[model samples]
Target chain A: MAADQLAPERDTRAVEAGLDALDGGGELLPPRPGPWQVFVRSVLPPVVFMAALVGVWQLAYVAELKPSYALPGPADVWQTFWGTVQDGRAVEAVWVSVSRGGIGFAMSLVIGTLLGLAMWGSRWLRAAVGPIVSGLQSLPSVAWVPAAIIWFQLTDAAIYTVVLLGAVPSIANGLLTGFKQVPPLFDRVGRVLGLSTLGRVRYVLLPAALPGYVGGLRQGWAFAWRSLMAAELITYSPSLGLGLGQLLSIGRDLSSMSLVITSIALILLVGVAIELLLFAPLERRVLRTRGLTTDR
Target chain B: MTQVREQAPTRNTVAPPPAPAAVRVDGVTQVFERGRPPVLEGVDLTVAAGEFVCLLGASGCGKSTLLNLVAGLATPTAGRVEVSAERPALMFQEPALLPWLTARGNVELALKARGVARGARRTEAERLLELVNLGSHGAKRVHELSGGMRQRVALARALAQDSSVLLMDEPFAALDAITRDVLHEELTRVWTEQQLSVVFVTHNVREAVRLGQRVVLMSSRPGRIVREWQVDIPHPRAIESPAVGALASEITAELHREISRHGR
Candidate 1:
C-alpha cells in the first residue's frame, strides 16, 4: 500500500519536472506589434517613394532637359489635368473605360476560374484544352483586335471578346498551378479526416491554392485592361462614347499634345489605382493570414 | 518462454474487450518497383484496442512505408491490412497544420470533415484544445505558435478525429529534447485517458520504450520484425532507469548491425 502511494507521488513529480523544463525555454507566444506601428511601417515607405518620384519629375522639367511638347513639364501635365476636369471629359472618359473594363473583367474572371477548375479537376480536359490555353496566353491581347472587330462587328461584344481572350488563359493557368502545388500530405490528411472530394476542394485545395489563384487574378486583370484599351482604340463607334483610348486617338488626330499627355497619364493612373487600392490590399490580406508574407 | 506464459493473463486483462485487433497486418509486402526486391516482406502484426505499440527501426527500414500502408495512403503490393473501425488518423514529424488557420480552426476542420454541425464545431474544437492543455490558444494562428505549441495543436487535431486507431510517424522528432519529453508525457496521459490504440513509428529506441507497452524492432533492407520486447515498466517510465537504458542500448546495437549489413 505504501509502495503504491509512493509510486503516484513519484510519477506526479516527474511530470511536473518535465513540464517545468519545457516551459523554462520561456514564453512560446509571439509578440504582437502595436496597430500604429504596423500601420506606419506598411504605409510610410510607399508614400515616401511616390513623393521622391514626383520630385524627380518636377526637377527634370525645371532643368529644361526636353522640349515641352516632347516631354511635357510637370506643370504642363497638371494644367492639362485641371483643364480636362474643367471640360468634364476627363471624368467622362474615366467612367466609360472603368465601366467597360469592370463588366468585361467580371466575365473573364468567371470564365477563367471555371476553366482553371476544369483543367485541375480532370486529366482528360487538361490534356485536350491545356495547350490551347497556353497558346492563347502567349498571343498578345492586341493581336486579337482585328479578329474581335471582325467577329462582333466593332460592337461592345467585340471589345468584350478581346478582353476575355486576353484574361481567361491567365486566370485558368493560375488556378491550375495552385491546385497542382497543394502538398500531398494535406491531401492525405484531408482524406483521413473523411473529407469528400467536394469538401477537399472547398477547404484544403482552395485555401492552399489561394496565393497562386490571386497571382493569376492579378495577371488576368492586367490583360483585361490592356485588351479593352486596344479594342477601344481600333473600333471607334459613336455609340461607344469616348473612353481614354478614344481620347488618345482624338488627341492624335487633332494634334493636341496636352490632350494626348493628359489621356496617357489618366490611363496610367487608373491602372496604378486599381492595383494599389484594390488588388494589393486583397493579396496582402491573404498572404498575411496564410503567413506567407510578413509585414515586419 | 515461461515469462511469456506468465505475462499472457496480464496482457489479456489489460487489453480492452474487442472482437479482433484494432489493426491487423497479415503477410503485407510493399514493393518499390515491379522488378526490385520488396521493401517490407511478409510482415504480420496485430495491435489490440487501447494498446500502445512502437515500431523501432533505422533509416531505410521502411517503417514509415508500413505506417503509410496502414493509413490507407499506400497499398501493400502483397497481403492485406485490416482496421476494425474507421480509418486511422496520421501525424507527421512536422505539425503540418494548415498555415491559414488558427489552432482551433485546424481542429475544427477535422470535425467539419466528419460532418459535425457548425453550431457544435466551435465547442468540440475548444474541448480538444483543452484536452491538449491549449484551451486558451484557440485564436492563435499557426505561425504565431512555437514549434512545440504547433505539435500540440496537431495532436489535438489528430484526436479530434476520434478514431479507434492512431498512426504517428515520428511526430516529435523535430522538437527539442525538452519539448519532446514533455510531449511524451502529455501523449501518454491523453492516450490512457482516451483509450486509443497507437502504432507509433520512431527511430529513437528510448522514445519507443518511454511510451509503448510493446516495442517492435525491425531489421533494415526488406524490413522485417526481428524481435519484440514487452515493456513491463509502468507509466511515466524514467529514461535513465536501468531497465529502460538496457533495452535502449540493446535496440541501438541491433539497429547498428542492421545498418552495417547495408554498408557491406
Candidate 2:
C-alpha cells in the first residue's frame, strides 16, 4: 500500500526535475514565430528603404532638378542600358574588361603572395624591401601610367604594367600583416612537435594567415580593375579591343549621352557583382569557421 | 590523524634504483636580462623513468622558465639538460589545441610530426584518446568541447608524441575545482598505465602533494630548488585526509618562507 502510494509521487517529481533541467540547465527550444515572421523581419525594411530611394529619384527627375546630361533619369539610364545590350556592344565591352581584370588579378595574386612570403621569411629582405613596398602602396597607380606608357609604348603591356603596380602592394601588405598576427603559441607548438621549417609554413602559418591573404586578394582585384580602366581610358589604342573604359571615351568624344550612361552603369554593375558573388561569400565563410562571426 | 610518511634517507634510496632518468637537468641556470636581474640560477632536478614529479613555486619563481628549458622551446643559458630518448612532449596552461582541428585530428597532427606510420596513425591516436577517457570525442571540434574535455584531448595529443618524458606547465590551473579534481584522478590513472615520466609545474600546494611522487619547491627571482619532498602516500590520495592536509601545510609553509626571503 505504501509503495503504490509513493510511486506516483516519485514519478511526478522525476518529471518535474526533468522539466527543470530542460528549462534551467540546458539550452531550451526558443519560441517559434509565425510563418511570415522571418520574411517580415528580414525582407520588409530593405524593400521599403529601396522603394523610398527610388521614389525620391523619380521625384527629383520630374521636378527637372538638374540637366539630363548631368543627372540622367532612372528610366533614361535603363533605356540606355537595354539599348546597349540589344545592340550586343555591352556584352563585348563586359567580356573585354573582365578578361583584362581577371588576368591582371590572377598575376597579381601570384606575385604578391610570393613577395609577401619572401618579406616574412627573411629579416634582411624585409628590411631592404619592406619600406619600398609600403611606399608603393601609398603612391597612386595613376602615377605609374606615364612611366608605364614610356616603358611599354602604349600597348596592352602598358595597361598590364599599371595594373601590376596598383594591385601588388595591397596584396603584399595584407600578407605581411597577416604573418605578423599569427600567435607565438602556434610557433611554439610547432617546434615542440618537431615540425620542419617547410612543414610549419605549410601546416600552420599558411592556414592561420589565409583569411588575411584572401582579404588582400579581394583588395588587389579591385585595384587591378580600377588601374586597368584608368590606363585604357588614358591610352586608347584601336589595336586593343574597346573595353568599358574605351567605350566610355568613345561616347564622350562623340557626345553620346546614352552611351556614356550605359558604359558607366556596366562598370558599376560588374564591380558590384564580383564583390557580392565571390569575395563577400568567401570572407563570410572563413570568418564563420573561425568563430569570428556571430551564429545568427 | 594518519601519520605523514617521513622521507627515506637519501643514501638508502640508492639514486632512485638506477632506472633510466627520462629527464635530467644538472645545474641548469637560465638568465634573462629584460633590462633587469637574472631570472633563474643553478636549478637542478631530475625525473626517473615512470616517476611523476611536480615543480612547485610562487609566481615569478621561473617555474615556467624551467619547464620551457626542458621542452626545448627555449635553451637554458647554462648547464646540461637532457631527455634520454627524443624531445620531451609539452603541455601548456591552456589547452592550446588548434581551433581548426577536431580533437582526434589534433592528436593525429602530433603523430604525423613524429613521423608515425600512416597505417598505424589513426588507431594509435584513438588509443591515446581512449587512454585519456575521451574515446567517444574524436569527432568533436576543439571549441565544442568543455574545458575539461579540451584538456583531455591535449593530454591525448601529448601522448601521441610517444615521448617518455612529458613536461606540463600547470595544465589544470585554469580549470574549476571539480573539473580539476576529476582531471587529477584522470591524470593519475593515465600516468600509471603509461609509465611515462612527468614534470608538472604548478603553484597549488595540495595539487603538488596529491599527484607527485616528488615535489620540488622553488624560490623566486632567479629561481632555485630550496626543498625537495618525496611523497609516499598511497594511490588515490584523499585531499582532505589528515595526511594530505598535513603535508600540504608543511609545503605551503616552506613556500611562504621562500617567498619572504626574496624581500632581502
Best by TM-score: 1
Encode model 2's per-residue lDDT on B1-264: one tens digit a residue.
111223435412424557778888887878777667557777777788999999999999899999998888788888888887578899999888876677888899899999999899899999998887667778776656777778888999998988888899999999877667667777887799888899999999999988988888887876878778887677666555566676789889888887888777
Best-fitting candidate, scored by DockQ:
1
What's the lDDT for all of these models? 0.83, 0.81
What TM-scores result for chain A when each predicted structure is judged separately against the true chain A?
Answer: 0.82, 0.82
lDDT (tens digit, per residue) of candidate 1 on B37-89: 77898788889988899999988778999999999988899989998767798
Candidate 1 — which residues are off by over 4 angstroms? A1-73, B1-20
For candidate 2, report its TM-score. 0.88
Q: How many steric clashes between backbone atoms does each model show?
A: 0, 1
What DockQ values do the models have? 0.34, 0.18
